[model samples]
Every structure is written in structure tokens, then in C-alpha cells.
Target: MADHRAALRAVVTQRMLTDPAHDLAHLDRVWLIAQTIADQRTNQRVLLAACYLHDLINLPKDDPNRHLASQQSATESEPILAELGFAASEICNTQHAIAAHSYSANIPPESPEACILRDADRLDALGAIGIARTFAVSGALGRALYDIADPFAEDRVLDDQKFAIDHWKTKLLNLPAEMVTDGGRDLAHKRVTQMLGFLEIFSEEIGHPLPINWKSV
Candidate 1:
């Protein structure tokens, strides 16, 4: 199993795209986070495999097939798992975890491994690193950092597709509320606060006066 992990790492190194957000560094980060929250009851092997292989395939954020990326990644991972000599049950469990980890997939995790993977990966989208990943994707997409006219989207309908900062109001701000475990939730709240602090300062810097603590729209 140890050798299999090494081999799987090699496979991903050879195949993963140069995606700035979902790169090998992202996988390693998620893997490390999973170890923190996972307990003795869960299958570390499946969770570990899912960690390494969840983003085995990457897609552009705006790609029409973005929602299908997780499913496709699961489909593509089967052969790789088999080649690594994963047993049938373990492969299927790993596949389930991978297929369901995407935010877009909306597939309820059926196992502890899936929950840990999803929770940990989503955590990567919340903190300072999350901000870096968001801006990286935005820059790569040639997106403006924010809408000058309505930087906080107070009156306008939030459209992240048009601006990067809109993503905080539309998605990132909502992550702390969705975390699945006590540890995940506690860390997420801290991260969310830190992110809001950044936004508050950024708003002041941009002279937008966008209210970071708006109770409502």
C-alpha cells in the first residue's frame, strides 16, 4: 500500500495539468488537512487515495463541463487505481470519494473518507491560501479583480463570472457555515474572519467603502 501511494503520486505528477489552483501542491495540502480531522474509525487508505486523486483531472473554472469534472475524474481514476493493484472494494470506495468531492457535484458523501475529503478540500477554498487560489484562477481567466462600480455587489446581482471578489460574497463567505466537522468548522470560522479582514482592508484601499459586515443585501 505504501508503494502504491508512491506510484500513484508518480502517476499524478505525470498527468495533472498546470492548473494554478488544483495543482499537486493543492493535493498535498488537502492530504495533510485530511490527516488532521480524520479519526481512527475511517479508512485512511481510501481517504489517502482520494486525497491524491480527487483532482486527478482539472478543468477551467468557466468551462461548460466544469460540473462534470468530478465524475470524469472518478471514471479516469479507475484504471489508475487498478494498475496500482487496489482491491475492488477499495477502488470503488476511493472512486465514490473522488466523484463526490466537487462543490458542483453536490453528491452527498456516503462514507467518512468522502466527508473528510470534501470538508478538507473545501477548507482550502476558505483561508489565505484560498484567496491566493481564487485570485490565481481569476488572473488566469483574465478576470478583473472586482467591479469598480459595485465592488461589494450590494445592489447588483452577484456575478462571480464577471469579477473575482464577487466570489467571496457569493461563495467563500458561505463556506464556514457548510463545514462538516468540529475541527473543520472551527478552523473555517477563523479563516473566514481572516478573509473578511482582508476584504475590509481591500475595500478601504480601493475606496469602495464596501461594507464587509453587511447583515443583509
Candidate 2:
């Protein structure tokens, strides 16, 4: 069982590494956060495996078919797990967890492992790492940092963000409240506070008029 689990992890980790959107480091962060949150009542193996492999299907960052990609990834992951000698039940649970990880998909996690995986994935979107990913993804999609109109509009699609900074107001700032696990929520509170502080300071700096001596360097 242990060998099979290790082999499965290796395969998925490699896939994640090669995938641009949800890269290997994202998987590592999810596993780290999952480990911190998982308890005696939770299945660590299931949670970690799910966290690492949830985004195996490389969906376009702006694709409207987000749920379809998640479902496809979940469906494809089962065969890999079965080939790696995972039990049928374990494979099914992992598939469900993977399928439910995406927030835009809106599929609620049904098990403890799934909940932990969801929370861990969300935690990756919160603090310093979250900020980095937001910009990385935004830059990859050629989004600007701010738009004069509809800066905080929730109805605006992912492509509508003129800049990466606008994403904080659109989605990133709202993630903490949606987290599913207690540990995830705790970590999210600190990270959210950090993000809010950054935004406040940024606004103050941008709002103030530049001094005459402060020439462009």
C-alpha cells in the first residue's frame, strides 16, 4: 500500500510540475497546508494525494468550462490510482475530492478528506503565495492591475480584470470566508489580514500626491 501510494504521488507530482497553471509548487503548498490541518479524524494519505493531484487537468486560466475540466481531471485520476494499486473506495474518494476542489465549479466537498483538500487548496490563494500566484496568473493572461470602472465588480469574469491587483478585490479577498477547515480558516485570517494591510498601504501611497523632489528614477 505504501509503495503504491508513493508511486502514485510521484506520477501526479511530475504531472503537476509540468503543468503551467497549477504547478508543482502549488501542489507542495497544498500538501503542507493539508498536513497542518489534517487530524486523527482525517485521512492524511487521501488528503495529501487529493491535494497534489486535484488540478491534473490543465484548464485554461480563463476557460468558462472550469467544472468540465475538474470533472475530467477527476475521471482521469481514477485509472492512475487503480493502476498504482489503490483500493476502489480510495480511488473514488480521491476522485470526488479532486472534482470538488475548484471554487468556481461550486461542487461542495462531501468528506473530511475532501474538505481538508479544499481548504488547503484555498489556503494557497491567501497570503504572500496567493499574491504571487495572482500576479503570475494575471500576467500569464495579460491582465492589468486596475480598471477605473467596476474595480470591485463580482459579475466581471476573470478576463475582465484590467490588472492583477484588481483580483484581490474580485476574488482573493473573499476566499478566507469560504475555507472549509478550522485550521485553514485560522491560517486564512492571518493571511487575509496581511493582504488587507498591503492593500491599505498601497491605497495610501497611490492616493498621496508625489513630492516635487520625487522624480522618476
Candidate 3:
């Protein structure tokens, strides 16, 4: 196989790519998460490749075209993967994992590696680190911390574009339910609890007694 890792690192560094929340460090974390969740049925190399290369075409959270980023990545990855000397099956497996890992893509993971990579990526989007990332992206976009009138989004249309807090209700809070693996689900539940605790603290800071009803709305 060709030296994809070396080639990718060179590309990332040479481009001076820097998204505070989705940079190489984030890839490292997701790779670790995948490694931690890897099973006998999973192809380790394919899964790891997907983890590192999935965000090769990352879109900003507020981008109107963000949902298309995954498939776009999959389409864009072929030449790079081919040049890396990936076998046909490996390239297919890696592309599927990358394509389906996006929450917005809503593509059903079709293989063990696909499911594992999906769970792994979502796991990275929960808990303390997830909080930091949410705010970092939000801040970069000039999004308000919360809606001053309805911080917890109890009585208004949730708009993560305008307020980062709405993301908790809109996406992050439901991630544990979406986890693809038993272990990933368990960890998601734990991380979501920490997120809930943080929400409680946020409510106190805002002096709002809003309660979370993620199941209904």
C-alpha cells in the first residue's frame, strides 16, 4: 500500500488547515475512538483511514451546503485512496464509512466498519470535548451563546445557527439514541449525562427553570 498517512499529513500541514474543533487533533481523537471500539468484524485499516480522511472536506456548521459534505468527501476521496494503493474493497469500505458517518447524511451504515465509524464519530460529538467544540465553532461563526429570551429553547424554534445552545436540543442530546454499538451507546449515555448536567448549570446561570424533553421536542 502507498503511504497515505504520510501523504495526508503533508497535505494537511502544507495547506495550513486549521479549524479549531475539526483539525488533525480531532481526527486523532476519532481514530482513538475507532480503535477503542474496533471489533473482529471491523477492518481496522479501512476504519482508521476513514477516521483520518473523513473530514478532508469539512464544511462549516452553518454552511448551507454542509449536509452534502459527506458524499462530496466520498466522491473526492477516490483518487487519493487509489493513489494510496488501497484495494478496491478497502476503498469501497473506507468511502462508505466516511460517507455514512455524517449525522446529516442519514445514510444507514451498511457494514461493520461503517457502523463502527459512525458510532465513533458521534461519540466524539458528545460530553465535555463536544461542548468545547460546539462553542468553538459557534464562536467562530459569531453565534450567540444562547437566545437571551429563551435560552433553553423551551418556547421558540430552535436555531443552532443563531444560538449554539439549540444544538444540544437539536442534535447532540439525541446522539446517544443514535449510537450504533452497545459500547458506543453506553458511552454516549454517560457523556450525554454530563451534557445534561452542564445544561442544568447553564439554566442556573440564566435563572431559567427550563426542563429538557428531548423525546417530544
Candidate 4:
């Protein structure tokens, strides 16, 4: 079991390192944060593994073939896990966790490890790292930071507008509540607060000058 787990980790690490969007450094950060939280949890191994591998398959939001790509990767992952001799249960759990990590899917994770993995994945979308990734993704899609008005909102349409800012308002800010383990919640709350503060400063800077009295000491 130990050897199989190690082999699986190697495969995930290699794949993530090669992936362009969610690269190795991103996976490493998530795993580091996951370890800090998982230390207090019962299923650290599962959570850690899921954290590193959750984004193994990167799907571009604007790609017309996005759904097909995700399904294909999920299908491929099962065979890879089977070849690695991972237990059926562990393979299923890991796959489910990965599938649920997508923003569009919105599937509820089944286990504490899954929840922790999801939170860890989303945490990468906040603060400095998140800002870089957001613009990277936006640039790739040829999107400006602020569209004149919400393009998709007119049709009561679903679009990236909500996905972009809501990362700050919803998942990033609400992470403390969504976190499954106590330690995860504690650590997440601090980052969430930092992200919120960053957003506040960002909005003020871009929108207008603050009054002299409103300036901090």
C-alpha cells in the first residue's frame, strides 16, 4: 500500500509539474497548506494526495471542448490509478475529489479529505498568487479587467463575471465556514482576511483617491 501510494504521488507530481495552468509550484503550495491543516485531521494521507493531484487535468473555461476534456481526463485517471494498484476506494475518492474541484461543476465533496482538498485548491485563487493567475487566465481569454457592463448578465446569463469576483466574495471569503477540519478553518480565516483586505485596497486605488483623513497613519 505504501509503495503504491508513493508511486501514485510521483505520477501526480510529474503531471502537475508539466501542466501549464495549474503547474507544479501551485500544487506544491496547495500541498504545503494541506499538510498544515491535515496534521490535525485523521485522513492526512488522502487529503494530501488529493491536494497535490486535484488539478491534474486543466480545463480552459472558454474552450468549446472543455467538458469533453474533463471527462476524458477523469476517464484516463481511473485507468492510471488502477495500474498503480491503488485500492478501488482510494482511487474513487481521489477521482471524485478532483472532479468536484472544478468551479463550474459544483459537486459536493463526500469526505472531510475531499472538502479540505477543495478548500486548498480554492485558496490558490486568493491574494498575490491568485491575482497573477486571474490576469493570466483573463489575458488568455482576451478579457479586459472590467467589462463595460456584465456581458452575460443581460440574459440572466451564466458567465465568468460571477466566477471572477465571486472568488473573493464567495469561496475565498467563505472558506473558513466550508473548511472541514478545525485547523483548516483557522488557517483559512487568516488568508481570507488578508485577501479581503487586499481587495479593499485594490478597489479604493482603482476607483478613486481616498480623503486625506481616511489615510492610515
Residue pairs with colliding backbones in model 3 are: none
* Model 2: worst 10 consecutive residues (lDDT sum): 208-217
Top-scoring candidate (TM-score): 1
Candidate 2 colliding pairs:
144-162, 144-163, 145-163
* Local accuracy of candidate 1 as per-residue lDDT tens digits, 1-217: 5776687788899999998888888988998899898888789888888999998778888888888899889989999888877899999999999998999889988888988898899999988999999999999999899988888888799899989998888888888788777778887888887887787789889998857454222
Which predicted model would earn the best lDDT?
A: 1
- Candidate 3 residues 1-217, lDDT tens each? 1366667655555533589987887887887888787778877778767877788788887778988888887777777778877899899988999899998888999998888889988888888999999999889999999988888777788998899989888889888888888878888898898888887777888998757474332
What TM-score does each of the candidates earn? 0.94, 0.84, 0.90, 0.69
lDDT against the true structure, each candidate = 0.86, 0.74, 0.82, 0.60
For every model in order, what is the number of clashing pairs? 0, 3, 0, 0
TM-score of 3: 0.90
TM-score computed on alpha carbons, candidate 2: 0.84
Worst 10 residues of 1 by lDDT: 208-217
Candidate 1: RMSD to truth = 1.8
Model 3: which ten-residue window has the lowest total lDDT? 8-17
Candidate 4 is scored at a TM of 0.69
lDDT of 4 at 131: 69
What is the per-residue lDDT of model 2 for residues 70-158, given as tens digits with 9 covering 90 to 100? Answer: 77889888878777667888888988998898887789899998889888888888888887777778877888765545333334554
Clashing pairs in 1: none
Candidate 4 lDDT by residue in tens digits, 73-175: 4555777767766678877777776676655566777776767676677677755777677767666666665423432123243345434543344334555
